[model samples]
Target: MQAVIMAGGKGSRLAALTKDEIPKPMAPFLGKPLLEWQLEQLKRYGIRRVTLVVGHLKEKIISHFGDGSTLGLELDYVEETAPLGTAGAFPLLLPKIESEHFLLLFGDIRFDIDLARMERFFLEKRAECLLFAHPNAHPYDSDLIVTDGENRVTGFDSKHNVRTGWQDNLVNAGIYILSRDMLRRVPEVKKTDFEKEILAPMAAAGEAIYAYRSPEYVKDVGTVDRIRAAEEEWRSGFPAKRNLEFPQRAVFLDRDGVINRYNGFVRTPEELELLPCAAEGLRQLNSSAYLAIVVSNQPVVARGETSEAELETIFNKMKTLLGREGAFVDDVFYCPHHPDSGFPGEVKELKIDCDCRKPKTGMLRRAAERYHLDLSACYLVGDTTGDIQCGKNAGVRTVLVKTGEAGRDGKYAVTPDLVADDLAAAATKILEEQ
Candidate 1:
């Protein structure tokens, strides 16, 4: 696949480091230029052809990696005689890119991502544009993204935008895969922003713009402090070793009490009702870097009160309700085994101890493996002691919400790290810590 690196910016924020007549992308990082590191990563990912859009100190970049042969890449250059904003350089390369879709990235960012997976997602969705989004340390002052249940980009909020009471923490990571047709949206003006002038407007008009939210390592070293942190992260080998393999953080939840009213076991779709603000609570996580996962104990399946197919229908209805509110859960895992017997229609085989049941950590471990999660970095939110114990056993932080049992008369083997009134409040606590 082809990739475009926008290396023309003067990077005034990093002026101290780039004061030696070198562009920000050429600034020294760990004994080599930052751009060289990025090129090596691209080459490692099997991307051999790259186009460098150069302007500021263009000669330095050209002299260092001329024709990209030293890096085993087919190099091309687009010299912007005058300043064109982020998306402006793209219009100039419309005639140069032969592929229908090409990767676009900013030169100032440092990241270790699975580009092949991103490409597959972009193709699977048939999206006109797909942006890489993640949660940063400072969401309050970052460009946030608003997406629907399907990960479609519904709105883009720049950092300058006034804060609403509660917002999603997912921010644009400054990487994208753009279909050639998206070039039509680029303004004819010499200078224009890709976010402000192109992508946001297209999304506002209901175009197919999606956000690929992952917990992979993507950081912009635009300041001194961040550059230092990036170097530290690299030296620690956390980004290259763990993040590249499985880096998503998750918020594990209990189904009945946490997501819906818990009068009794929900036997049918018609009986399911969402708890107050539950959809909104999940919507916040849906737009953040955390994966919304449901780990529930459903003993009724073993008692023959509810069949697996019927349970799936109920979950689907719940998802539909959440989608109406622009919310969603990434995955759901339920344990159907019950350690009792002698019920009238009980499934004899399932009435035994199972590892996936609550308080056993099996479900959480499975999720950790499937999504490449770091258990310690995850959080488990539930209304019962079993949920808290499950989280503790899995080595994740735990929160107890008062919506179900109210944390009253609770006799359990473990205590929650925090307690909240409901799911929404629990989400607030989690984001505050972030």
Candidate 2:
């Protein structure tokens, strides 16, 4: 596969590390240039041909990699004499990119992702552009990507906007797969922003721009502090572990009475409030190897008490609140069905018995499939017997928290593998043993 890297950035933010002697992509990372690491990763994913858009000390980069023969890569360069925006270099390289679809990303990011998986998704969706989107620790100041449940790009929310209500923690992680046809928008390529000029307008016009949301490790390590953190992450093997190519371990959490205050049924965003132990516990999971995923049973949708859109708002509130505390969940899976519903305004179609409800193991199975997780190595934390039963059904370890129902609901007869005072305690126990 072919790839284009926007390496023209002067990297003014990384001046301390670059010392202005080298370009940002040429900055040293763990004894090697950052661009070299990126090339190695692409080669690992069977991408041998790469075109680097170079500027601001371009000769140093060319001098180091030459033809990329030492690294088993076919490398070429496109030099920018003047400052060109992100998509500006595309017009100059129109004769170079031959593939129908090629990968594109900034030069400053440190990432280890399942590019094959992303490619499969891009092809499956017939997407014109596929963005690698994920939840981040700080969404409050990040430019957010708005997507529907189908992962279609709906809108772009700027960080400068006065975000009033709940917002999902979906941030574009500076990685994308673009179709060659999309490059036609850069006619003259005179200082054009990719997001603001090309992709945003295409999305607005109802184009096939999709967001491939994943929990993979794709972070911008442009600043000195971020580079130090990336070094530690690389040393710890966290980035590679996060890739979908490897088996993942997750801590499945029940929403109500576990992460949030159990107030009967959370019908509205205002009604959803995070518990005291939730943020700290999730933060611990965020730092650990375990992917923090939420699996909940929201029968309110079936009961007609709350619509799916409203329920999404509730989840958005949960994520927004967690992001404020430097914590975020990798994903959320909820069962909106309820059997034997004779309530006031229940939706008849959703009243059928479904396998996704608690004690059914469907939610865990879905998560396992999506993340390539090992059920035996996973753990589920919840406050009800139904949650424990679901974990048992899924063949995963279960931790019953002594909050909310605390297994007093008597909805199911099951024994938990471990017991904890709260979610924080549950996280500690799981981390200590592993």
Candidate with best TM-score: 2
lDDT of 1: 0.83
- Give the per-residue lDDT of model 1 (tens digit) for 296-352: 998989999999877767776776566556676766788989998998999999999
Candidate 2 lDDT tens digits, 259-287? 99987999999899899999999999998
What's the C-alpha lDDT at position 61 in model 2?
93
Which residue runs of candidate 1 sit more than 4 Å off their true CA positions? 187-189, 242-370, 373-434
**In candidate 2, where is summed lDDT lowest over 10 consecutive residues?**
181-190
RMSD of each: 9.0, 1.1
User: What is the Cα-based lDDT of residue 71 in candidate 2?
Assistant: 95
> Model 1: how far is 10 from its true place, Å?
0.5
